[model samples]
Target: MGADPTAIVVGLGLPSDVGTGWLDDLTDGFRDECDLVGAGVAGGDTTRCDLVVISVTALGDLGGRAPVTRSGARPGDVVAVAGRLGHAAAGLALLESGHEGLPGPDGRRRDDPRRDDPRRDGRAEPYGSDERREDGVAGLVGAHRRPRPPYPCGPQAAALGATAMLDVSDGLLQDLGHVARASGVGIALDPGAFTVTPEMERVARLLAADPLDWVLTGGEDHALAATFPAEVRLPPAWTVVGRVTGGEGVQVSGRTVGQGGWDHFRM
Candidate 1:
Protein backbone atom coordinates (compact mmCIF):
# COMPACT_ATOMS: atom_id res chain seq x y z
CA MET A 1 0.00 0.00 0.00
CA GLY A 2 1.07 3.58 -0.59
CA ALA A 3 1.23 5.55 2.64
CA ASP A 4 3.39 8.11 4.36
CA PRO A 5 5.11 6.77 7.42
CA THR A 6 4.65 8.97 10.47
CA ALA A 7 5.96 7.10 13.50
CA ILE A 8 7.69 3.91 14.59
CA VAL A 9 7.40 1.81 17.72
CA VAL A 10 10.26 -0.43 18.74
CA GLY A 11 10.63 -3.42 21.03
CA LEU A 12 14.03 -4.64 22.09
CA GLY A 13 14.95 -7.90 23.74
CA LEU A 14 18.52 -7.27 24.78
CA PRO A 15 21.00 -9.46 26.54
CA SER A 16 22.19 -8.58 30.03
CA ASP A 17 25.83 -8.57 28.95
CA VAL A 18 25.28 -5.78 26.39
CA GLY A 19 26.95 -2.45 27.18
CA THR A 20 25.24 0.94 27.49
CA GLY A 21 27.36 2.30 24.64
CA TRP A 22 26.00 -0.43 22.39
CA LEU A 23 22.44 0.57 23.29
CA ASP A 24 23.21 4.21 22.58
CA ASP A 25 24.57 3.37 19.15
CA LEU A 26 21.55 1.24 18.34
CA THR A 27 19.13 4.01 19.26
CA ASP A 28 21.13 6.57 17.35
CA GLY A 29 21.08 4.44 14.22
CA PHE A 30 17.34 4.05 14.56
CA ARG A 31 16.89 7.80 14.85
CA ASP A 32 19.11 8.41 11.83
CA GLU A 33 17.11 6.01 9.65
CA CYS A 34 13.78 7.36 10.83
CA ASP A 35 14.89 10.92 10.16
CA LEU A 36 15.54 10.02 6.54
CA VAL A 37 11.82 9.30 6.06
CA GLY A 38 10.44 12.05 8.31
CA ALA A 39 9.35 9.56 10.94
CA GLY A 40 10.06 9.63 14.69
CA VAL A 41 10.42 7.09 17.43
CA ALA A 42 7.23 7.21 19.47
CA GLY A 43 8.76 5.27 22.40
CA GLY A 44 9.24 1.53 22.90
CA ASP A 45 9.81 -1.25 25.42
CA THR A 46 12.86 -3.26 26.35
CA THR A 47 13.46 -6.48 28.28
CA ARG A 48 16.26 -8.85 29.11
CA CYS A 49 16.80 -11.89 26.92
CA ASP A 50 19.54 -14.34 26.06
CA LEU A 51 20.04 -12.68 22.68
CA VAL A 52 19.30 -9.38 21.01
CA VAL A 53 15.93 -9.05 19.31
CA ILE A 54 14.40 -5.98 17.69
CA SER A 55 10.80 -5.51 16.62
CA VAL A 56 9.52 -2.45 14.83
CA THR A 57 6.06 -1.35 13.78
CA ALA A 58 5.53 1.62 11.52
CA LEU A 59 2.38 3.74 11.33
CA GLY A 60 1.43 5.52 8.16
CA ASP A 61 -1.32 7.65 6.62
CA LEU A 62 -2.79 6.94 3.20
CA GLY A 63 -3.88 10.56 2.70
CA GLY A 64 -7.31 9.51 1.42
CA ARG A 65 -5.88 7.21 -1.25
CA ALA A 66 -7.20 3.67 -1.37
CA PRO A 67 -4.78 0.96 -0.29
CA VAL A 68 -3.21 -1.11 -3.06
CA THR A 69 -3.49 -4.86 -2.55
CA ARG A 70 -1.80 -7.84 -4.18
CA SER A 71 -5.12 -9.20 -5.36
CA GLY A 72 -5.86 -6.23 -7.56
CA ALA A 73 -3.55 -7.15 -10.42
CA ARG A 74 -5.30 -7.98 -13.68
CA PRO A 75 -4.31 -9.64 -16.93
CA GLY A 76 -2.52 -7.41 -19.47
CA ASP A 77 -1.16 -5.12 -16.72
CA VAL A 78 2.53 -4.36 -16.97
CA VAL A 79 4.87 -5.36 -14.16
CA ALA A 80 7.54 -2.88 -13.14
CA VAL A 81 10.09 -2.37 -10.41
CA ALA A 82 11.43 0.73 -8.67
CA GLY A 83 14.92 0.84 -7.20
CA ARG A 84 17.53 -1.95 -7.20
CA LEU A 85 17.16 -5.64 -7.87
CA GLY A 86 19.96 -7.75 -6.39
CA HIS A 87 22.55 -5.57 -4.70
CA ALA A 88 21.69 -6.82 -1.22
CA ALA A 89 21.96 -10.46 -2.22
CA ALA A 90 25.31 -9.91 -3.87
CA GLY A 91 26.51 -8.16 -0.71
CA LEU A 92 25.39 -11.06 1.43
CA ALA A 93 27.31 -13.45 -0.79
CA LEU A 94 30.48 -11.41 -0.24
CA LEU A 95 30.01 -11.55 3.52
CA GLU A 96 29.48 -15.29 3.43
CA SER A 97 32.71 -15.57 1.43
CA GLY A 98 34.47 -13.87 4.37
CA HIS A 99 35.00 -10.32 3.04
CA GLU A 100 33.46 -8.20 5.79
CA GLY A 101 35.07 -5.09 7.24
CA LEU A 102 37.87 -5.23 4.67
CA PRO A 103 39.64 -1.91 4.14
CA GLY A 104 39.49 -0.11 0.80
CA PRO A 105 42.34 1.09 -1.46
CA ASP A 106 42.83 4.10 0.86
CA GLY A 107 43.12 1.77 3.89
CA ARG A 108 39.82 3.23 5.20
CA ARG A 109 36.69 1.42 6.37
CA ARG A 110 34.78 2.93 3.45
CA ASP A 111 34.04 -0.60 2.16
CA ASP A 112 33.25 -2.23 5.48
CA PRO A 113 30.80 -5.15 5.31
CA ARG A 114 28.72 -6.24 8.28
CA ARG A 115 25.33 -7.58 9.52
CA ASP A 116 25.03 -10.71 7.25
CA ASP A 117 28.14 -12.81 7.57
CA PRO A 118 28.19 -15.22 10.54
CA ARG A 119 31.33 -17.29 9.85
CA ARG A 120 33.51 -14.87 11.82
CA ASP A 121 35.71 -17.76 12.96
CA GLY A 122 38.76 -16.18 11.28
CA ARG A 123 38.91 -19.13 8.95
CA ALA A 124 37.80 -17.57 5.68
CA GLU A 125 40.13 -15.49 3.47
CA PRO A 126 39.24 -12.17 1.83
CA TYR A 127 38.13 -12.30 -1.80
CA GLY A 128 39.40 -8.89 -2.94
CA SER A 129 43.19 -8.56 -2.97
CA ASP A 130 43.47 -5.69 -5.51
CA GLU A 131 42.14 -2.13 -5.65
CA ARG A 132 39.51 -2.64 -8.40
CA ARG A 133 38.18 -5.89 -6.93
CA GLU A 134 38.20 -4.37 -3.44
CA ASP A 135 36.11 -1.39 -4.51
CA GLY A 136 33.53 -3.56 -6.27
CA VAL A 137 33.33 -5.92 -3.30
CA ALA A 138 32.86 -3.04 -0.90
CA GLY A 139 30.05 -1.52 -2.95
CA LEU A 140 28.20 -4.85 -3.06
CA VAL A 141 28.75 -5.42 0.67
CA GLY A 142 27.47 -1.93 1.50
CA ALA A 143 24.24 -2.73 -0.30
CA HIS A 144 23.60 -5.60 2.10
CA ARG A 145 24.15 -3.55 5.23
CA ARG A 146 22.49 -0.33 4.12
CA PRO A 147 19.57 -1.12 1.80
CA ARG A 148 17.84 2.09 0.67
CA PRO A 149 14.20 1.45 -0.21
CA PRO A 150 12.52 3.69 -2.76
CA TYR A 151 10.01 5.15 -0.27
CA PRO A 152 8.42 7.92 -2.32
CA CYS A 153 7.94 5.62 -5.32
CA GLY A 154 5.31 3.61 -3.47
CA PRO A 155 2.90 6.53 -3.30
CA GLN A 156 3.78 7.58 -6.82
CA ALA A 157 2.94 4.12 -8.11
CA ALA A 158 -0.43 4.20 -6.38
CA ALA A 159 -1.15 7.65 -7.70
CA LEU A 160 -0.49 6.33 -11.19
CA GLY A 161 -3.24 3.70 -10.75
CA ALA A 162 -1.18 0.70 -9.73
CA THR A 163 -3.36 -2.39 -9.61
CA ALA A 164 -1.06 -4.38 -7.34
CA MET A 165 2.11 -3.48 -5.46
CA LEU A 166 4.62 -4.97 -3.04
CA ASP A 167 8.18 -4.55 -1.82
CA VAL A 168 10.78 -7.11 -2.95
CA SER A 169 11.78 -8.08 0.57
CA ASP A 170 11.89 -11.85 0.08
CA GLY A 171 13.31 -12.16 -3.42
CA LEU A 172 11.67 -10.97 -6.63
CA LEU A 173 10.27 -14.35 -7.60
CA GLN A 174 8.99 -15.20 -4.12
CA ASP A 175 7.32 -11.85 -3.44
CA LEU A 176 5.78 -11.71 -6.89
CA GLY A 177 4.49 -15.20 -6.36
CA HIS A 178 2.39 -13.80 -3.57
CA VAL A 179 0.94 -11.20 -5.91
CA ALA A 180 0.26 -13.75 -8.61
CA ARG A 181 -1.42 -16.17 -6.25
CA ALA A 182 -3.47 -13.47 -4.63
CA SER A 183 -4.57 -11.93 -7.90
CA GLY A 184 -5.25 -15.36 -9.46
CA VAL A 185 -3.13 -14.42 -12.47
CA GLY A 186 0.22 -15.32 -13.97
CA ILE A 187 3.33 -13.11 -14.12
CA ALA A 188 5.75 -13.59 -17.00
CA LEU A 189 9.09 -11.88 -16.47
CA ASP A 190 11.88 -11.03 -18.89
CA PRO A 191 15.29 -11.85 -17.45
CA GLY A 192 16.97 -9.54 -19.92
CA ALA A 193 15.04 -6.65 -18.49
CA PHE A 194 17.14 -6.75 -15.31
CA THR A 195 20.53 -5.13 -15.44
CA VAL A 196 23.63 -7.05 -14.43
CA THR A 197 25.73 -4.37 -12.75
CA PRO A 198 29.48 -4.51 -13.25
CA GLU A 199 30.06 -4.89 -9.54
CA MET A 200 27.76 -7.88 -9.47
CA GLU A 201 29.40 -9.45 -12.51
CA ARG A 202 32.88 -9.01 -11.06
CA VAL A 203 31.95 -10.46 -7.69
CA ALA A 204 30.09 -13.37 -9.27
CA ARG A 205 33.04 -14.15 -11.49
CA LEU A 206 35.37 -14.23 -8.47
CA LEU A 207 32.98 -16.39 -6.46
CA ALA A 208 32.05 -18.71 -9.35
CA ALA A 209 28.40 -17.81 -8.93
CA ASP A 210 25.69 -16.75 -11.35
CA PRO A 211 24.84 -13.05 -11.22
CA LEU A 212 21.41 -13.63 -12.73
CA ASP A 213 20.58 -15.90 -9.79
CA TRP A 214 21.16 -12.99 -7.46
CA VAL A 215 18.92 -10.72 -9.51
CA LEU A 216 16.13 -13.26 -9.68
CA THR A 217 16.19 -14.89 -6.25
CA GLY A 218 18.15 -12.63 -3.88
CA GLY A 219 16.06 -10.71 -1.35
CA GLU A 220 16.18 -7.80 1.18
CA ASP A 221 16.71 -4.97 -1.31
CA HIS A 222 13.19 -3.66 -0.57
CA ALA A 223 12.60 -2.52 -4.16
CA LEU A 224 9.01 -1.84 -5.12
CA ALA A 225 7.30 -4.20 -7.65
CA ALA A 226 3.97 -3.05 -8.97
CA THR A 227 1.45 -3.74 -11.72
CA PHE A 228 -0.21 -1.01 -13.74
CA PRO A 229 -2.22 -0.56 -16.90
CA ALA A 230 -0.03 -0.99 -19.97
CA GLU A 231 -0.80 2.56 -21.05
CA VAL A 232 0.43 4.14 -17.84
CA ARG A 233 3.50 6.29 -18.30
CA LEU A 234 5.82 5.25 -15.49
CA PRO A 235 8.55 7.42 -14.07
CA PRO A 236 12.18 6.81 -14.99
CA ALA A 237 12.76 5.22 -11.60
CA TRP A 238 10.48 2.35 -12.59
CA THR A 239 11.67 -0.40 -14.95
CA VAL A 240 9.17 -2.56 -16.77
CA VAL A 241 10.09 -6.22 -16.30
CA GLY A 242 7.06 -8.29 -17.29
CA ARG A 243 3.29 -8.43 -17.61
CA VAL A 244 0.37 -10.05 -15.82
CA THR A 245 -1.23 -12.99 -17.63
CA GLY A 246 -4.46 -14.96 -17.55
CA GLY A 247 -3.11 -17.98 -15.64
CA GLU A 248 -1.56 -18.43 -12.19
CA GLY A 249 2.00 -18.47 -10.74
CA VAL A 250 5.13 -16.65 -11.97
CA GLN A 251 7.49 -17.44 -14.83
CA VAL A 252 10.73 -16.00 -16.16
CA SER A 253 11.47 -15.66 -19.88
CA GLY A 254 8.32 -17.69 -20.53
CA ARG A 255 9.51 -20.67 -18.49
CA THR A 256 8.72 -21.66 -14.91
CA VAL A 257 11.59 -21.26 -12.45
CA GLY A 258 12.54 -23.54 -9.59
CA GLN A 259 12.29 -22.73 -5.90
CA GLY A 260 15.40 -20.70 -5.12
CA GLY A 261 14.49 -17.82 -2.84
CA TRP A 262 14.89 -17.23 0.90
CA ASP A 263 12.65 -19.41 3.02
CA HIS A 264 13.05 -19.22 6.79
CA PHE A 265 11.51 -22.61 7.41
CA ARG A 266 13.68 -24.25 4.76
CA MET A 267 16.78 -22.58 6.07
Candidate 2:
Protein backbone atom coordinates (compact mmCIF):
# COMPACT_ATOMS: atom_id res chain seq x y z
CA MET A 1 0.00 0.00 0.00
CA GLY A 2 1.01 3.63 -0.55
CA ALA A 3 2.22 5.82 2.34
CA ASP A 4 -0.03 8.39 3.96
CA PRO A 5 1.66 11.69 4.69
CA THR A 6 -1.02 12.72 7.22
CA ALA A 7 -1.04 9.50 9.23
CA ILE A 8 1.15 8.21 12.04
CA VAL A 9 3.79 5.54 11.29
CA VAL A 10 3.62 1.98 12.71
CA GLY A 11 6.27 -0.73 12.41
CA LEU A 12 6.11 -4.54 12.74
CA GLY A 13 8.41 -7.53 12.40
CA LEU A 14 8.05 -11.27 12.02
CA PRO A 15 9.09 -13.20 15.13
CA SER A 16 11.80 -15.83 14.72
CA ASP A 17 9.25 -18.53 15.55
CA VAL A 18 6.60 -16.81 13.49
CA GLY A 19 5.23 -18.61 10.42
CA THR A 20 3.85 -16.93 7.30
CA GLY A 21 0.31 -17.02 8.72
CA TRP A 22 1.46 -15.33 11.91
CA LEU A 23 3.15 -12.61 9.88
CA ASP A 24 -0.06 -12.10 7.93
CA ASP A 25 -1.99 -11.92 11.19
CA LEU A 26 0.37 -9.27 12.56
CA THR A 27 0.12 -7.20 9.36
CA ASP A 28 -3.64 -7.45 9.33
CA GLY A 29 -3.77 -6.48 13.02
CA PHE A 30 -1.70 -3.41 12.32
CA ARG A 31 -3.91 -2.40 9.41
CA ASP A 32 -7.00 -2.73 11.59
CA GLU A 33 -5.53 -0.53 14.34
CA CYS A 34 -3.20 1.95 12.65
CA ASP A 35 -2.67 3.76 9.38
CA LEU A 36 0.44 1.93 8.21
CA VAL A 37 2.79 3.81 5.95
CA GLY A 38 4.50 0.87 4.24
CA ALA A 39 5.42 -2.75 4.93
CA GLY A 40 7.95 -5.14 3.33
CA VAL A 41 10.88 -7.52 3.91
CA ALA A 42 14.58 -7.36 3.06
CA GLY A 43 17.35 -9.91 2.49
CA GLY A 44 20.67 -10.51 0.68
CA ASP A 45 21.95 -13.56 -1.19
CA THR A 46 24.24 -14.99 1.46
CA THR A 47 25.11 -18.52 2.51
CA ARG A 48 23.48 -17.87 5.88
CA CYS A 49 20.39 -15.70 6.08
CA ASP A 50 19.93 -16.39 9.77
CA LEU A 51 17.51 -13.50 10.36
CA VAL A 52 14.43 -12.21 8.62
CA VAL A 53 14.40 -8.40 8.40
CA ILE A 54 11.35 -6.17 8.34
CA SER A 55 11.35 -2.36 8.53
CA VAL A 56 8.57 0.22 8.74
CA THR A 57 8.41 4.02 8.78
CA ALA A 58 5.48 6.14 9.90
CA LEU A 59 4.72 9.79 9.03
CA GLY A 60 2.30 11.63 11.30
CA ASP A 61 0.74 15.10 11.45
CA LEU A 62 0.59 16.95 14.76
CA GLY A 63 -2.53 18.90 13.85
CA GLY A 64 -0.61 22.17 14.41
CA ARG A 65 0.47 21.19 17.92
CA ALA A 66 3.88 22.35 19.05
CA PRO A 67 6.37 19.49 19.29
CA VAL A 68 7.65 18.86 22.80
CA THR A 69 11.37 18.30 22.77
CA ARG A 70 13.72 17.27 25.58
CA SER A 71 14.85 20.88 25.95
CA GLY A 72 11.57 22.12 27.39
CA ALA A 73 11.56 20.43 30.83
CA ARG A 74 11.90 22.93 33.65
CA PRO A 75 12.19 22.97 37.42
CA GLY A 76 9.03 22.02 39.41
CA ASP A 77 7.74 19.87 36.55
CA VAL A 78 6.94 16.29 37.64
CA VAL A 79 8.86 13.49 35.93
CA ALA A 80 6.84 10.34 35.19
CA VAL A 81 6.37 7.22 33.00
CA ALA A 82 3.13 5.78 31.56
CA GLY A 83 3.77 2.10 30.83
CA ARG A 84 5.37 -1.20 32.03
CA LEU A 85 9.05 -1.22 33.06
CA GLY A 86 11.68 -3.82 33.99
CA HIS A 87 9.57 -6.87 33.05
CA ALA A 88 11.68 -7.65 30.01
CA ALA A 89 14.85 -7.47 32.07
CA ALA A 90 13.36 -9.88 34.60
CA GLY A 91 12.17 -12.13 31.79
CA LEU A 92 15.66 -12.22 30.29
CA ALA A 93 16.96 -13.77 33.49
CA LEU A 94 14.37 -16.56 33.34
CA LEU A 95 15.16 -17.37 29.73
CA GLU A 96 18.88 -17.44 30.46
CA SER A 97 18.17 -19.94 33.30
CA GLY A 98 16.44 -22.27 30.80
CA HIS A 99 13.25 -22.37 32.84
CA GLU A 100 10.13 -23.75 31.17
CA GLY A 101 7.55 -22.07 33.42
CA LEU A 102 7.01 -19.34 35.98
CA PRO A 103 7.18 -20.55 39.59
CA GLY A 104 8.33 -18.88 42.71
CA PRO A 105 10.83 -20.46 45.08
CA ASP A 106 7.95 -21.89 47.18
CA GLY A 107 6.17 -23.32 44.10
CA ARG A 108 3.17 -20.98 44.29
CA ARG A 109 2.38 -19.31 41.02
CA ARG A 110 2.50 -15.52 40.86
CA ASP A 111 -1.03 -14.42 40.23
CA ASP A 112 -1.52 -11.89 37.50
CA PRO A 113 -4.65 -9.89 38.25
CA ARG A 114 -4.92 -8.83 34.65
CA ARG A 115 -6.21 -12.30 33.93
CA ASP A 116 -9.30 -12.13 36.15
CA ASP A 117 -11.76 -14.12 34.05
CA PRO A 118 -12.28 -17.72 35.19
CA ARG A 119 -12.16 -19.11 31.68
CA ARG A 120 -8.88 -17.25 31.15
CA ASP A 121 -7.74 -18.34 34.64
CA GLY A 122 -6.73 -21.77 33.36
CA ARG A 123 -4.43 -20.19 30.79
CA ALA A 124 -3.12 -17.74 33.36
CA GLU A 125 -2.24 -20.39 35.97
CA PRO A 126 0.37 -21.98 33.75
CA TYR A 127 2.01 -18.57 33.49
CA GLY A 128 2.80 -18.78 37.20
CA SER A 129 6.21 -19.33 38.82
CA ASP A 130 8.17 -21.29 36.24
CA GLU A 131 5.77 -20.15 33.56
CA ARG A 132 6.40 -16.58 34.58
CA ARG A 133 10.09 -17.30 34.37
CA GLU A 134 9.60 -18.58 30.86
CA ASP A 135 7.49 -15.54 29.95
CA GLY A 136 10.17 -13.29 31.36
CA VAL A 137 12.69 -15.05 29.16
CA ALA A 138 10.40 -14.67 26.19
CA GLY A 139 9.87 -11.00 27.06
CA LEU A 140 13.56 -10.20 27.17
CA VAL A 141 14.09 -12.13 23.97
CA GLY A 142 11.39 -10.07 22.29
CA ALA A 143 12.80 -6.86 23.70
CA HIS A 144 16.26 -7.66 22.35
CA ARG A 145 14.83 -8.60 18.96
CA ARG A 146 12.37 -5.70 18.68
CA PRO A 147 11.44 -2.63 20.70
CA ARG A 148 7.91 -1.36 20.87
CA PRO A 149 7.81 2.37 21.51
CA PRO A 150 5.02 4.10 23.41
CA TYR A 151 4.16 6.41 20.51
CA PRO A 152 0.90 7.58 22.06
CA CYS A 153 2.68 8.67 25.26
CA GLY A 154 4.68 11.24 23.30
CA PRO A 155 1.58 12.73 21.74
CA GLN A 156 -0.33 12.23 24.97
CA ALA A 157 2.27 14.19 26.88
CA ALA A 158 1.92 16.95 24.35
CA ALA A 159 -1.83 16.84 24.72
CA LEU A 160 -1.74 16.71 28.51
CA GLY A 161 0.45 19.76 29.06
CA ALA A 162 3.75 17.92 29.27
CA THR A 163 6.58 20.44 29.34
CA ALA A 164 9.18 17.97 28.12
CA MET A 165 9.30 14.31 27.04
CA LEU A 166 11.40 11.43 25.69
CA ASP A 167 11.18 7.65 25.21
CA VAL A 168 12.91 5.45 27.82
CA SER A 169 15.18 3.53 25.44
CA ASP A 170 18.17 3.66 27.76
CA GLY A 171 18.09 3.10 31.50
CA LEU A 172 15.74 5.45 33.35
CA LEU A 173 18.51 7.34 35.12
CA GLN A 174 20.49 7.75 31.91
CA ASP A 175 17.49 8.90 29.88
CA LEU A 176 16.43 11.33 32.60
CA GLY A 177 19.97 12.69 32.47
CA HIS A 178 19.44 13.39 28.80
CA VAL A 179 16.28 15.29 29.64
CA ALA A 180 18.10 17.12 32.41
CA ARG A 181 21.08 18.06 30.24
CA ALA A 182 18.86 19.08 27.38
CA SER A 183 16.71 21.27 29.62
CA GLY A 184 19.64 22.64 31.63
CA VAL A 185 18.14 21.21 34.81
CA GLY A 186 18.82 18.57 37.42
CA ILE A 187 16.58 15.70 38.57
CA ALA A 188 16.28 14.18 42.05
CA LEU A 189 14.72 10.72 42.03
CA ASP A 190 13.18 9.42 45.24
CA PRO A 191 13.81 5.72 45.76
CA GLY A 192 11.39 5.86 48.67
CA ALA A 193 8.77 7.27 46.37
CA PHE A 194 9.07 4.21 44.15
CA THR A 195 6.67 1.33 44.84
CA VAL A 196 8.27 -1.82 43.53
CA THR A 197 5.76 -4.40 42.35
CA PRO A 198 5.88 -7.95 43.70
CA GLU A 199 6.98 -9.53 40.42
CA MET A 200 9.78 -7.03 40.01
CA GLU A 201 10.97 -7.37 43.57
CA ARG A 202 10.76 -11.15 43.35
CA VAL A 203 12.78 -11.15 40.17
CA ALA A 204 15.32 -8.88 41.76
CA ARG A 205 15.60 -11.16 44.79
CA LEU A 206 15.87 -14.23 42.58
CA LEU A 207 18.55 -12.58 40.47
CA ALA A 208 20.33 -11.22 43.55
CA ALA A 209 20.28 -7.77 41.97
CA ASP A 210 19.01 -4.59 43.50
CA PRO A 211 15.47 -3.90 42.32
CA LEU A 212 16.14 -0.19 42.55
CA ASP A 213 19.15 -0.56 40.28
CA TRP A 214 17.09 -2.45 37.75
CA VAL A 215 14.47 0.30 37.77
CA LEU A 216 17.10 3.01 37.76
CA THR A 217 19.82 1.65 35.49
CA GLY A 218 18.33 -1.18 33.38
CA GLY A 219 17.01 0.20 30.08
CA GLU A 220 14.67 -0.81 27.21
CA ASP A 221 11.46 -0.46 29.26
CA HIS A 222 10.04 1.65 26.37
CA ALA A 223 7.81 3.53 28.82
CA LEU A 224 7.42 7.28 28.28
CA ALA A 225 9.47 9.58 30.51
CA ALA A 226 7.76 12.94 30.63
CA THR A 227 7.80 16.12 32.69
CA PHE A 228 4.47 17.60 33.66
CA PRO A 229 3.63 20.76 35.55
CA ALA A 230 3.60 20.21 39.30
CA GLU A 231 -0.13 20.83 39.58
CA VAL A 232 -1.20 18.72 36.62
CA ARG A 233 -3.11 15.55 37.50
CA LEU A 234 -1.21 12.57 36.07
CA PRO A 235 -2.87 9.33 35.10
CA PRO A 236 -2.65 6.20 37.30
CA ALA A 237 -0.29 4.46 34.91
CA TRP A 238 2.21 7.25 35.49
CA THR A 239 4.74 6.92 38.32
CA VAL A 240 6.36 9.92 40.02
CA VAL A 241 9.98 8.75 40.12
CA GLY A 242 11.75 12.11 40.36
CA ARG A 243 11.61 15.86 40.07
CA VAL A 244 13.27 18.45 37.85
CA THR A 245 15.53 20.96 39.57
CA GLY A 246 17.31 24.10 38.42
CA GLY A 247 20.78 22.72 37.66
CA GLU A 248 22.92 21.03 35.00
CA GLY A 249 23.00 17.30 35.88
CA VAL A 250 20.92 14.51 37.42
CA GLN A 251 21.00 13.08 40.92
CA VAL A 252 19.37 10.43 43.04
CA SER A 253 18.72 11.75 46.55
CA GLY A 254 21.41 14.44 46.05
CA ARG A 255 24.11 12.01 44.79
CA THR A 256 25.03 12.25 41.12
CA VAL A 257 23.92 9.24 39.08
CA GLY A 258 26.58 8.35 36.53
CA GLN A 259 25.83 8.22 32.81
CA GLY A 260 25.99 4.47 32.18
CA GLY A 261 23.82 3.93 29.16
CA TRP A 262 24.55 1.72 26.14
CA ASP A 263 27.65 2.68 24.17
CA HIS A 264 28.79 0.31 21.42
CA PHE A 265 32.33 1.64 21.34
CA ARG A 266 32.71 1.34 25.12
CA MET A 267 31.32 -2.17 25.08
Give the best candidate by lDDT.
1
lDDT of 1 by residue, 27-81 (tens): 8767766776788999889999999999999888899999999999999999999
As a TM-score, model 1 comes out at: 0.85
Q: Residue-wise lDDT of candidate 2 within 1-267, one digit each (tens)?
A: 011234334434434565877565545544433422232222212122346554455455667777778888889998887665665555556456554245655675544422222222222122112224334333443443333444455666677888888777677778888889889998887777765567667666766766666566556667678899999887776788888998767777777766543231121
Tell me the TM-score of each prediction against the true structure: 0.85, 0.67
Give Cα distance to truth, residue 42, candidate 1, Å.
Answer: 1.1
Error of 1 at 180 (Å): 0.3
